[model samples]
Target chain A: MERGGVTVRVLGIDPGLTRCGIGVVEGIVGRPLTLVDVNVLRTSASVPIAQRLVTIERGIDAWLDEYSPDAVAVERVFARSDSSTIMGTAQASGIALVAAARRGLPVATYTPSEVKAAVSGSGRADKAQVGAMVTRILRLDAPPKPADAADALALAVTHVWRGGARARIDAAVAAGRTP
Target chain B: MERGGVTVRVLGIDPGLTRCGIGVVEGIVGRPLTLVDVNVLRTSASVPIAQRLVTIERGIDAWLDEYSPDAVAVERVFARSDSSTIMGTAQASGIALVAAARRGLPVATYTPSEVKAAVSGSGRADKAQVGAMVTRILRLDAPPKPADAADALALAVTHVWRGGARARIDAAVAAGRTP
Candidate 1:
């Protein structure tokens, strides 16, 4: 699951009840990243709610088993968005987190703005811009369709760049030093 | 997990990130419910968020394995409550749902008002009234501690009373008729 001497394999998840996207990437921070796989798992609305959650869990488990990434990256859900869609998103995120945690993988979360800024150099970058950047960074022939896949890849790239071992150690030290 | 000739074992969940409550009840409609078990599973905020989710998942799995309930009942999450607590609650609910779904058990969600009404005959009943009714219904010496346990038991009672086999059939028919 390694690319170079200092490579890190990352699995990023853009969680959604209807379409949960997963992307795996491998590379060091400064080097060009390789796209291992990209997929958008979907659960139909017609299924019972519990069964839908089961579908999401199975999809996530399959990805984790297949990729065995060094770290799992997830989109941080904000409670401020008081919408039904956000509730489903939060639930999907929880399922993904549990899957990664059960495997004892490090899990990091980044906000949407952080993901966009990391991928496109602008927090305010639109979807198309982020897609372009993801395609360029992964050296893909074209942007991943449906946007969710691209967002997942962006999340992986962001984690690999911003939340590596050195960054986590620094964060821990900063928290300790603050107290 | 059986009580009488007509036995219904229900595992009710009051989902929360920090203090998720689980109560198992065995009984029949129009009969005094038996309290099988009650517990609160806690995950502290100081721990890593992913680990917290893993703890929750493990707690739920343990309950399901031990209780072997016929059905799982959960408190439904509302998006209107724009608070951090609701976010964690939703996440925990998701984990519980997935655990039950993986076991092929039926999952039902009751709103707070519905639970109160089913337990106390009043939708606007306060926590004390609900707790008192829970004690009376189960013939307990005293109310379960921390309030969450009572709420979980109430949810299980509500599901047994309102969402039995007939109600589930009706729901399926309604869903099928919807289009």
Candidate 2:
């Protein structure tokens, strides 16, 4: 799937205390995206919260150093009825934002539905559908193992397709021109 | 308030996105506590969440470098009906944990009730009562401005009283001895 030029690389993160999924994708809008890497960072439940956060920070830093993506996208955490789970997720997401911002990388956040809609054209798409779309788009023989990993790849694809177009429009507007 | 010979310095943090309160206190339990410092770090709501977190990290790092506290105490964030406020608070608290853990400082978390009980001898103490107790305990001319600052001071006092005792107990147990 090829279109215009201006290739952009994006690192997307699905933050969690137990398993933080990270994926990198490279491509321009409307083009077949290449999966640079995909992995999940895990921290044990027995570990102290402070140490768990440090582990996530180190993992994100390593990915940033290795991939050096143009932008970072993190799943926006929402408060749920389960306060404990939401707290950990929100905290983990915060570390992702801090890591990307520390390196002066543009950071964007997308809701789960946003990523689902961008990939499958349906905000209400289920996980299996989203994963199927991601596998098809990346031309992978199989979907990424673990739901978090596939979710992260979906986030990167969403950003590359939506964020890329938004960035272009913003640049054109700043330059006093019409896109 | 001088029952013990050991004097431990503690830096307590009340984390929030709009205003994070930081305070340092030095003294042994049952003795008059000295307020080393107390201040609030403020970030504008207009700022992006990622940049706001960076601002907090820098502020905490500066405090850690300046005080060299033996330990850190952070107020535990609780989930409330106000999901948005809690999300920011949880994120900010994560930064505090990371900054202290990175420095290898022992970190403890205390709930609001614990802080209030430690200072006012009542877990259900109101804000004004807690502030008055903090002012009187520290022998300050006035209560710390803004509730966050006073809350931070209370957290430090709580750690100095409870955490110090717990550490001694753990050490004694590790040594197979009695305190």
Candidate 3:
């Protein structure tokens, strides 16, 4: 639909300080077709934890700039035991949003459970299951490594299918309604 | 000094809820040169904020994979106005640390004052002064768009100089030991 029938691209981000996973998918909703890029970003502890987050942010920005995504989808936070860990999670998420917004791109966010449900058909889907589903869905030659990458792909797909009024539809489906 | 003579690459992060600024620099402490990347990450009010954090974390991870930074650095939290904001900041910081540690990277931290002095030659430097100095020192043609990106770069360069025992050195410097 955009620029002579090039399918709109959706960039999915799986946030974290050390290992951030990103997946780029092409196509439209109700049929998220292919996974273009699946990769993990890494950092060394010697640089300081906060620095690593910035390092990750820079990488994501570069990716965004290169691709010019139509929309961005990210996975939301999950509960963790440590207060410090949660703060890092929130900060990373903020960075991703700013990156997309600065480019005047719309953004969507999905919860861990919701992403799991959409991809795995179960809210409690584990990392491995989600990875398998992502691989199968994308028809990749190999499963994405570093777990987070697969999760990122799922978030992007979830946003396309289930974000916005799709949530309402899903809720209705749960209630056994067609509308 | 690297096997491939690849300039030592370090990624610095400033993790925040409202924004996370990230920067990457290559070279050793005193001879630091090149700014590979600088960017801001963002999210929104509508999405459950917690889930947003996770997406940020994953995004950072993907960046790390692409860049393969030698080390990661992050800014230390100083103070904030709101209690909820502080809680969120703390949680985000934790996630940043988790990313670094999970990757077996030795994480480091630098306080705001330390980062300011490193870049501006003033411990209590303001945002503009710090931003200006970062642009000057890094030879950036344009002032980094968002304040957070500049701050993240400062944190990274600071970590390069005095992240480990630099605090003690800074205190000594403050005592007029060295100019």
Candidate 4:
């Protein structure tokens, strides 16, 4: 596929304590997005919280160094009834944000609904629907294994479709032009 | 007063996004504790979450480098009705943990009640009582400023009192002697 125009690469993170999904996608709006990479970083629950956080940080730092994405996207954490799970997710998300920010890369967070709406055209889309749409959009052989991995890819595609537009508007406003 | 026997240096962090409290205390169990340092690291709420986290990481790294404490202590975060506040705190605490872990320092988390009990003889002690006890324990003329700073000192004192005893037991067990 002959690509033209500016390609914005984004690294997306689905943050979790045990299994953090990471994916990178490259493309601009209205174009076929290319999958750069996808993987999940896991930390042992038996380890201390501090050690687990360190492992997550190292994994994120390595991804940032390898891909050198223009921007990083992370799933925004919400308070859930399960306090322990939510706390772990929030902590993992923090590591991702700090890793990207330290590299001076722009970082953005999308709520689950926002990501789903962007990828599947409906905020209320189920997991299977989102997975199916992601596979179709990226032209993948199959949906990324492990829901976390697919969710991460969906987040990247969402950023490319949404954040790219927002960035342009921001650039225009900065240039003293109405976006 | 001249200090005697293995003094353990501990840095305690009361993590918050807006104002993170950091304090260092050095002492052995059953001895006068010394306040080495105390301060609060503030990040503007108007800043992006990623930027705030980066600011916190830098502040923590600086403290770790300067104090070189034997261990790091952080306050355990609990879920509250105010989701936003708890989320920010969880994130900040994560940053503190990773900062210490990255330096290969041992990290421990003490609950609020544990800290209160360690300092004030009652698990339900109020903030004022904890502050008064900390001031008296460290033999300081006044309580640390900004409540957060005082709370941080309290956490360090709690860890020094508790962790020191636990360490001795662990060491003795490692030496094949019943603690």
Candidate 5:
């Protein structure tokens, strides 16, 4: 099998201000597998408020450097109450996109429902169910810790499952021309 | 002391698209002091663009809720070469400011040069020097990691040193109560 064509490594991340959960997985084409590493990363705010974002910036760089996955997958914000929250989330998300795109990697996004569905066979599965299914699907001894890690893995799973289907459909629609 | 004497805990954030450095400081009588705690946060494009921001939003909320910082100090973006980069930075900074202000916390801003001067003897001091000085002034264990963290600390230091001064001057001017 061709190197690039056969195997793909993916990084999945869950974004939050204080903590961002990250998971990395390897996928083989035509195989319902690919599970690798996972971790829960944190950022603190005890310093002056002005520097918190800078703290975040450094962390992302380290994450990228550490994993260097083939593709990046992240969850999309489903809903938020506060306008301020939505705005902040938007900014952080932009940085994530910038980082991935800069590396010339294919980046994909999955919604909460989509990730849950992929992992748990239910779009509205609760966090615990998703975590359990993640363990089952990946054949792990237990679900990843702190919940966020499991969520990140589910996002990676969703991307691996859906990304291929979308690519093929887009190719078919374009009749071999770039979209 | 009057209840409305205006004690603002301004969380100053320096926005870097990749790093998204943040600093949280409390402003009393418009004078801020850097709190001891600080660190790097990370996110990746493999997540949905919106999710990354959500992470940031949550981080800010946790800080605000925990410290009850009265206002936020944000470093304004000077023009950048790339339109997309500037646009994203502006968007992110805008979001950070809004998140604080929307919660009835006033927001303030400072420029990069201004932050440098406030932290270091010279506005053009190199990053290492700035980092060294930041550690010295704040009594930090080491220079904040990943240039962005240093930058974030710089933003906080600037806001504490200069943002407070600006706010007081602005308040006096607005009230026609100059000393």
Candidate 6:
């Protein structure tokens, strides 16, 4: 029986303008993932837009520097829904991706449903269900707060359980194509 | 009257994932503008997402280093329409904002209508009209190519004219609040 591969640390971002949720988890697939940290970075709407983005960027930079995650996962921005928040969400997603890329870490994005499915085994799972499952999976005292934080942790867990495998396959294919 | 205010150089970005348009112009509000440079940074959708962002980042960095614009103007992302490209647009916009923020330059965003109104005197002016007006304002031999470049120039021009006044007002308010 394989004891799985090396444990991978992941930082997940639930991107938003008002509150960007960030979470870090470490574990190998099929193993109990340890919750390293989870929190939301908040910025006021009154500030200039560029300054708001700077706040998010600073948060992301701090997390990346602290956790030193092996990979990053962010919620895929869906342009069809939530017209009001879509732009801010997408902007946050870009900041997350760039932070990971600058560190040479692999970056992946999953739709909201995929994160729900990975954590709760239902693509249509509600936020409460996903939060409950995340609590159960990490064996935490309580579910992460603010919903966005829970979503971030769920994304981290999801990427470890799913994106990790896909990343491995991608690497192998890239290596194969190399001369 | 006092020959307008100080000359302001603006780097305007028409953010797009496939082709980000960048332009630089220098002028004082209510004065004739001088065209500096206009070009598009191309990135293929086939490349990895992070890599694409890096390309845009690099282009912005180079432009900032070369031109040292007094401020940056990016077209505001509107999420209500164009679901197909909204995410990419927002992401590109984020990169632009971050680039300017890092350089300690003022970053401003203008809605599409505001840009049209400032450049062509009609809020609902079409792209061709904006482009023609941009050419006339800059006294160019021809309008910048690929429309996106022209739009970028128009944004720069708009920011110097309309946004400059707004920015001054904002600064005054900020100063007034500081006690």
TM-score of each: 0.93, 0.92, 0.52, 0.92, 0.51, 0.95
lDDT of 4 by residue, A1-179 (tens): 75666889999999999999999999888889999999999999867788899999999899888998999889998887467688888889999999998988878899999999999889999999998998999999999978899999988998888887776775677578999
Interface C-alpha root-mean-square deviation, candidates in order:
0.9, 0.8, 7.6, 0.7, 9.5, 0.9
Can you give the lDDT of residue B150 in candidate 5? 75
The DockQ of predicted model 5 stands at: 0.09
The alpha-carbon lDDT assigned to residue A144 of candidate 1 equals 96
How well does candidate 3 match the true structure in TM-score terms? 0.52
Ranking by lDDT: 2, 6, 4, 1, 3, 5
**Docking verdict class for candidate 6:** medium
Candidate 3 per-residue lDDT over residues A1-179, each given as its tens digit: 34333456889998877778888888765554788787887777555454666677788888898877788887666444245565555556666765676565767778888899998899999998998998888888777887888888888777666564654564476578896
TM-score of 4: 0.92
Q: How much lDDT does each candidate structure score?
A: 0.88, 0.90, 0.72, 0.90, 0.66, 0.90
Off by over 4 Å in 4: A1-4, A168-179, B1-4, B167-179
* Model 1 alpha-carbon drift over 4 Å, by segment: A1-5, A165-167, A170-179, B1-5, B165-167, B174-179
lDDT per residue (tens digit) for residues B1-179 in model 2:
84557889999999999999999999987779999999999999867789999999899899999999999999988776367788888998999999999888888899998999888999999999999999999999999989999999999999998997776775576577988
Better of 1 and 6 by lDDT: 6
Better of 3 and 4 by lDDT: 4
**Displacement of the residue B134 alpha carbon in candidate 4, Å:** 1.0
Residue A8 CA displacement from its true place in model 4, Å:
1.1
What candidate 6 gets wrong by more than 4 Å, as runs, is A172-179, B1-3, B176-179
DockQ of each: 0.76, 0.76, 0.10, 0.79, 0.09, 0.79
Q: Runs in model 2 with CA error above 4 Å?
A: A1-3, A167-179, B1-3, B168-179
DockQ score of the complex predicted as candidate 3: 0.10
Cα lDDT tens digits, model 2, A92-132, are: 99899999988888888899989999999999999899889
Candidate 5 per-residue lDDT, tens place, B111-142, comes to 77677777887878888887887777666788
